[model samples]
Target: MKQYEYKFSFLPEAINDCEKVSDLETTCEVKGKYPCPCCCYNTFPVPKEDAIAYICPVCFWENDVFTSSDDEPSDENRGMTLNEGRRNYKILGACSQDMLIHVREPKSDEFPK
Candidate 1:
């Protein structure tokens, strides 16, 4: 318990400031010579057609969807295009906020390795 240096928790304010961010909302097709997040190869195909995510063949970094054709690509949306944004995906938009990853200090007497 003492070994733990810090813990992070979601702030209520974050809800007001938090924007939708999710892989389902941000994955985009990387056509042509574009670097793959995994192998940095420019020829990676769209990994998940349904999810629109990118998986590098060389490095094989699957589930690394983070590309958008829109002018604004951000972490919240995992880099999705404007048309395919959260607003476009109702189910995803609802769960997208869960990705915010709020944390809390250990309340139990457990040491982390």
Candidate 2:
């Protein structure tokens, strides 16, 4: 698998207010610019009440759901298999204390490679 590094940021005030920094709720203001692990495609992040799951832009399947092992498929994973080619689908990443604010181009001064 290829490794992709991206920068993430969080407001100090937001971090301080949350009981658990990793559980902070996020609202994707951009609407449709989330990261896509497969083929490095750019798309919207999957939204959830408390968290988001990282999804493939082209495949429209959650990363976890897409990468699930074949032997132990759960109900959720089973559902994902059905919509592997839908458009406008998204997936959220694992919850973390650090929330990503910007995704800049490589070699840019704001986000150096």
Candidate 3:
């Protein structure tokens, strides 16, 4: 497993008089860009690999490599199916209705080459 690290910071005024540091870890295998199932945009990391909760910025679809079929319900995606997400992306500009606020329009560079 790969040991990923992350760092976080808090505003000095938000935490009163305290200082803290975190050594977060993970086994994420993010790599080169690939097509996102929901948006068909080449902005996803790790082609066909376990997505490890990477959310697509363009479509807000939670990546789940286990979701192989368009109609398959994805447990990692709040019981939403890929087809449902794709339909939502087409009409609402996001994978799900609620995700509209979290998603952004795909940039020209994000499209498949």
User: Candidate 3 lDDT, tens digit per residue, 78-97?
Assistant: 99998999999899899888
Please identify which of the two predictions, 1 or 3, would achieve the higher TM-score against the true structure. 3
- Across 4-109, the per-residue lDDT of candidate 1 in tens digits comes to 6655666443436667799768855345244433223454434233334443333323332344444455454455443443343233422134432421222222
Q: Kindly give the stretch of ten consecutive residues in candidate 3 with the minimal lDDT sum.
A: 23-32
Identify the candidate with maximal TM-score. Answer: 3
Q: How close is candidate 3 to the true structure, as a TM-score?
A: 0.67
**Which segments of model 2 are wrong by more than 4 Å?**
1-30, 46-57, 63-75, 79-113
Worst 10 residues of 2 by lDDT: 93-102
Highest lDDT, which number?
3
Point out the worst 10-residue segment of candidate 1 by lDDT: 103-112
Backbone clash count for every predicted candidate, in the order shown: 3, 9, 0
Ranking by lDDT: 3, 1, 2
